[model samples]
Target: MQIAIDGPAGAGKSTIAKQIAKTLNITYLDTGAMYRAITKGVIDRKIDFADQKAIAQYAASAVITFKGQRVFLDGEEVTEGIRTPEVSEHTSEVAPIPEVRKVLVQQQQRIAEGTDVIMDGRDIGSTVLPNADYKFYLDAAVSERAKRRYEELQEKGGLNGKTLTDIEADIARRDYNDSHRAVDPLVCCDDAVRIDTTHMTIPEVVACVIDHVEDGTAK
Candidate 1:
């Protein structure tokens, strides 16, 4: 069975999906990280994000790994490289490309083969795993999301000296792109259980999801 979690940036998809996957004894795949990895590839290869052919070509040949919670790109252990401020900016540019999303979707589907899996991203509920047994759409207010992202970047110390204002602006810009993309845009599936996490804690959010699942209303 595959449980898909779809949400915007900083809506707790990664943390929540990981927790739920652990409880259900399933493998957790962070699809957003894959896009981020590809974004990093664009940076390394100097491919123009708007050039669909160029981005698609790089994505087609990209290698990504998840050793538990760690992410790697190619032969190098880019677990940290892909999450840099630079990748954060270019990932939105890369994520909306039709060809790039198609390639990543195929890779994501392949990872769910023969395993109980939980995958999270902007379009998982709508595009990647439309038939997922359990679908969740997590969200938070824009200001709240901006705050969460700001704090997270502060903790990671990966902002590369960028200001909090810069981070917030970048996240907001990505939000617009994600919601308006022509292919596999960010949308909450009607059947997906929506959880507004603006004022909720991690454990509280996880419990709500668990309760919903146990009651068969999560989808």
Candidate 2:
């Protein structure tokens, strides 16, 4: 069984997906993190993120490992390093390239094949796992999402004088870029169930998703 959770950043998909995977005893695939790892690679090498050729080569040749929730890039533990605002910016720039997306999508698909997986990302339900047993499009209000990021970035460090407004504007731009990008834009699949989490607590949202899974399990 596969559960595909599609949502924008800071929408709680990553945490929920991890918990859901633990609840279900399945592997959790954080596809966004894979992209972030690639983005960090490009940034570390001081290569142009917009160069489709460079990005594609890096993604195709890169080794991304996820053990439990920790992600490694090229054998180095970069679980937290790849989550910085700079890496996020690089991700936005490189992830839209068709070649990069193509290679990463292939790798993501390979990882989830023949396994019970909970995969979360911008295009999982729409493109990567359209045939998933359960598909959810998780969302929240912009301010709510921004607040989540603000608090997380504060805890994570490396904000570098960036305010909530700066994060909000970055998120807004990412929303536009993800949804408007020419290749595999971020959008909900018609068959995906939409879960608006603006007012719901974490447990509430997890319970809601568990209910869906329980129902599917019953079938």
Candidate 3:
């Protein structure tokens, strides 16, 4: 049972994926966190984003793993570290590089082989798991998505001095980058069930997806 959920940032992909995985007793893989791990690595090493070759090499050799919900990089726990605004800002740049995507996508596929996994990311349905048994494309209005992110950061105290407006701008920029990238850009697969979550609560969205999963039909 492989489930691929694709969406832009703050569309509630991670939250929804986690709940679905829990309900179905499957593993949840946050593919965005994997890219963020690499971005964090590059930033920690002070690598220049302009040097795509170096970044790609770093991504290829980076050891990223998920122990349950926590993310690890190079055998170190970086669950919170990778979620910093700095890492989020730079992940868009790192994720679009062909070489980097090649390396991470291969890793993601390997993890899903013979495993009941629910994975979410920009290109999961279209690129990483094209043949997945269940594919969903989740989306919401930019304002709604940004507001969700702002509240989440506020709760975590991870805002890093960023306001709601700043977060909104950042999300807008990310949407553009993810959609316009040259390699495996974020896209809704033709067979995927598209869910507009702008007006729905988390449980509502989760229940909608669960219905489709159990009945094998799009609601």
Candidate 4:
């Protein structure tokens, strides 16, 4: 079975999808990390975000791989590198380029061809896997989402020297960009079940999704 979970960033899609994949005995794919890897590449090469052609060329040629939860770019492990604020800030700019999306979508689709996979991203349900066996859109109020992200950064270390207000502003900007991008904006499919997670715990969200999977509602 193929499952697609989509939402704006920090909606707990990645966390919930990971647990669901483990419970269902399937592979979990974090498609956002793929774009972040490319963004890291762009930053490392010092390519200006305004240079669309250069960004596209770099993204198309990038070799991205995932092993369990680890992500690699080129041949180097970038699991932690891609999580930095710099890469996160620039990902919205790189991800919307048509060429970048084309290359990554092809790779993402290839990974799901013959396996039980749970994929999560801004466009998975609406674009990458429209015919997936199950589709869900996880969401939360902007304030709640920002709090989650702030706590995440705190766990990583003192909010990376930033504040809750800073993270809130960042999330708001990303939400706008993801929803208004020219290609495959972040919108839920008509058939996708919408889960408002503003007041839901991670375990509760996971249980809710597993319920759908086992009850044959997702088939």
Candidate 5:
């Protein structure tokens, strides 16, 4: 049972994917975190973003794993490390590189080969899991998405001096970049169920997704 959920940042993809996975007793794979892990690695190694070859090579050799909600790189835990604002800022740049995507997508596919997995990211439905048993595309207004991100940062005390406006602008930039990238850009699959989550609470959104999954299963 493979479920692919695609969405831009802060559209609640991770939160919703986690909930659905828990409810269905399946493994949840944070594919965005995998990209973020590579981004964090490149930043830590002081590699220039313009050097795609170098970044791709790094990604090829990166050992990313998930244990519960924690992310690990090369046997070291980097859950909180990869979530820093710096890593978040660079992840968009790293994710669009075709070579990097090739390496990571292969890893993701291998992980889902036989497991009951729920994976979420920008291109999961369109690229990583095209034949997934279930596919969903979740989206919300940029302002609402940014507000959620701002609140999350506030709770984590990791705002890093960024204002709500700054976060909104950044999200807008990511939406454009992710959608416009040449290789497997963010897209809603033809068969994916699209959900506008701007006015819905997490529970509402989760229930909607569950309803779809149940309806499909019943068919």
Candidate 6:
């Protein structure tokens, strides 16, 4: 069984998807991290974003490995490295490249084959896992989402000294980039269940998702 959760930045897709994966006893795949790894590689190689061919080639050739919560690119641990604000900004630029998404989507599919997995990202339900057993689109008001992101960054030790307003602005920019990307842009599939998480707590959201999974809403 494959489960897909997709949404804009700060919508709690990652946190909620993790809990859902745990409840379903399946592997949790963070597809966004995969793109970030590729972006980090491209940046490290000093490749210009204007060189689409080079960026695509870099993504295709890069070796990305995941061990539990740890992420490695080209055999180097980059779980936290990819979270840098720089990587975050560059990832949005590269992720929409057709060739880049092609390579990463293929890798993501390979990881889900013959296994029960819950994958979350901006385009999972719309592109990566369109036929997943259960599909969910998590959403929240921009303000609420930004607040959640700010709190999360605070918990992660100030997120490189970024202010809440800075994070909120970043989230807004990401939302636009994700939704307007030319290839496989972020969108909720018609069959997906949309969950407005603006006022819902983590446990409440998880319970709601699990309830749908337990019932016949998604099969």
Q: Top lDDT: which candidate number? A: 5
Q: State the lDDT of candidate 5 residue by residue for 1-219, as single tens digits.
A: 889999888999999999999999999999999999999999989999999999999999989988999999989899999999999999989999999999999999999998999999988888898999899999999999999999999999999899999999999999999999999999988899999999999999999999988999411
Candidate 4 residue 29 Cα shift, in angstroms, is 0.8
> Model 6: how large is the Cα RMSD against the reference?
1.4
Clashing pairs in 4: none
lDDT of 5: 0.93
lDDT of each: 0.87, 0.88, 0.92, 0.92, 0.93, 0.89
Q: How much is 181 displaced in model 3, in angstroms? A: 0.6
* lDDT (10s digit) by residue, model 1, range 1-219: 878899889899999989988887889998988999888878888777668898898889988888988888886677788778788877888888888898999999988878889999999988888889899999998788888888888898766777767767877888888999999999999999899999999999999988888888875
Q: Write the per-residue lDDT of candidate 4 for residues 51-155, one digit (tens) a residue.
A: 999999998888999999999999999999999888888899999999999999999999999999999999998889989989999999999999999988888
After the best TM-score superposition of candidate 1, give how far the Cα of residue 117 lies from its true spot, in angstroms. 0.7
List residue ranges in candidate 6 displaced over 4 A: 158-161
Residue pairs with clashing backbones, model 1 = 191-219
Where model 2 places Cα greater than 4 Å from the true spot, the runs are 217-219
lDDT of 2 at 112: 86
- In terms of lDDT, the poorest run of 10 residues in model 2 is 210-219
Q: Candidate 2 residues 1-219, lDDT tens each?
A: 989999887789989998888888999999999999999999898887557797788888999998888999999999989888888887888889888898889988998899999999999987898789899999999889998899888887767899999988988889999999999998988888889998998889889998988987412
